[model samples]
Target: MANRTTRIDPAMIDRLADMAYLDRNPAAVRKRVEGMEHLLERLFVIPGINRPVGLDVILDLIPVVGGTVGAALGAWMAWEARNVGMSKFQMTRMMGNVGLDFLLGLIPFVGAVPDFFFRSNTRNLRIIRKHLDKHHPSTVVIEQ
Candidate 1:
């Protein structure tokens, strides 16, 4: 037998181009912010479900990679938020949270346990969301 790899659909590829700006990490900072904003919504809050499902499941549940992946993703979002006009202090605080999650998550069972309940990504998202809502209302959907 010969090894083979799966092929992506061309139509899907085209659709990706037509999609929103913030769907992926573009070169521009604003675009990156836009991407993270969209991801935050889809990843945490289920559309039309009136409930939020944030990064707790991904980071805390899995083994070593879980928390690391989630923390990195959240950090990316926070980084972009700064480009979207978030203040330095706010960005620093978000970075602090990311650092905390990564550092504490290094421990075997105990660290992973707290990461779940803490839900650092969700908290960081909320912080970024609030700042964007208050200042850059035109960029993101701001809710009370």
Candidate 2:
């Protein structure tokens, strides 16, 4: 019987490192933010909408714990952004969207309606992506 060598791909290793450190170190942060940015735009950025709504809007439709669940989702995503080397300013902007969604969500039916349209996660994701672009300016950033 021949034994096969188990090898981890460098990209996987880098991804793990990136996640572990939350992209705090500049290079790692920049790379991970690229992902967050792409995800946000894809999920939320509607053509001609000017402002894209986010997934939290969907969450708000649920009964009692919906808003909390939505906020947690946004927070987890944002938490990764924090690790990915986002500046305090950028992080603040990201958190602001989540905060808005959470607060608006607390209201009754009216709030739920808006939540569907707000798309906070997508907005914050863009903020992270833009920051990375502004600071990092990589030539390879064209969307695949």
Candidate 3:
């Protein structure tokens, strides 16, 4: 076989750097957490009733594993919040929201029902947004 040269893709490296930035930067972290919250709490709206629904509710519908998965995702949001220098009191409140969501979600068929109203992910997102807006005012993005 002839000698071949392997070139590293600059675009791929940029993407990787962007992903890493999301974890450490306040602005990037805000977008990352907002995206997750949207996915978990408001991915779409149900027809007729016009109510929104998301993966959180769908996951809760499954037996034990679903709640665990949802809780894990919520915990991850809290972790990201900490990475942005969020206060301990705020983190505790965020975790409490996740914990309560997980506990309510453990109730088999009925568990999913609470998710529609509880919206823990949305609640947590609000906390993160408030913190970011107050401390990192430059990172704030005005919602249209």
Winner by lDDT between candidate 3 and candidate 1: 3
Ranking by TM-score: 3, 2, 1
Number of the top-ranking candidate, with TM-score as the measure: 3
**What's each prediction's clash count?**
1, 8, 0
- TM-scores for the candidates: 0.56, 0.60, 0.86
lDDT of 2: 0.67
Candidate 1 global lDDT: 0.64
Candidate 3 C-alpha lDDT tens digits along 10-120: 999999998887779998898889999999999999999999999999999998999999999999999999999998999999999999999999999799998899999
Compose the digit string of candidate 2's lDDT tens values, residues 9-69. Answer: 9999988986876436545655664454444334465578665544455456665477888
lDDT of 1 by residue, 57-80 (tens): 445556678667867787887867
Question: How many pairs of residues in model 3 come into backbone collision?
Answer: 0
User: After superposition, which runs of candidate 3 have C-alpha atoms over 4 Å from their true positions?
Assistant: 1-22
Span of 10 residues, lowest total lDDT, candidate 2: 33-42
Q: Quick one: RMSD of model 2?
A: 6.0
User: Cα lDDT of all candidates, in order?
Assistant: 0.64, 0.67, 0.94
Alpha-carbon RMSD of each model: 8.7, 6.0, 2.8
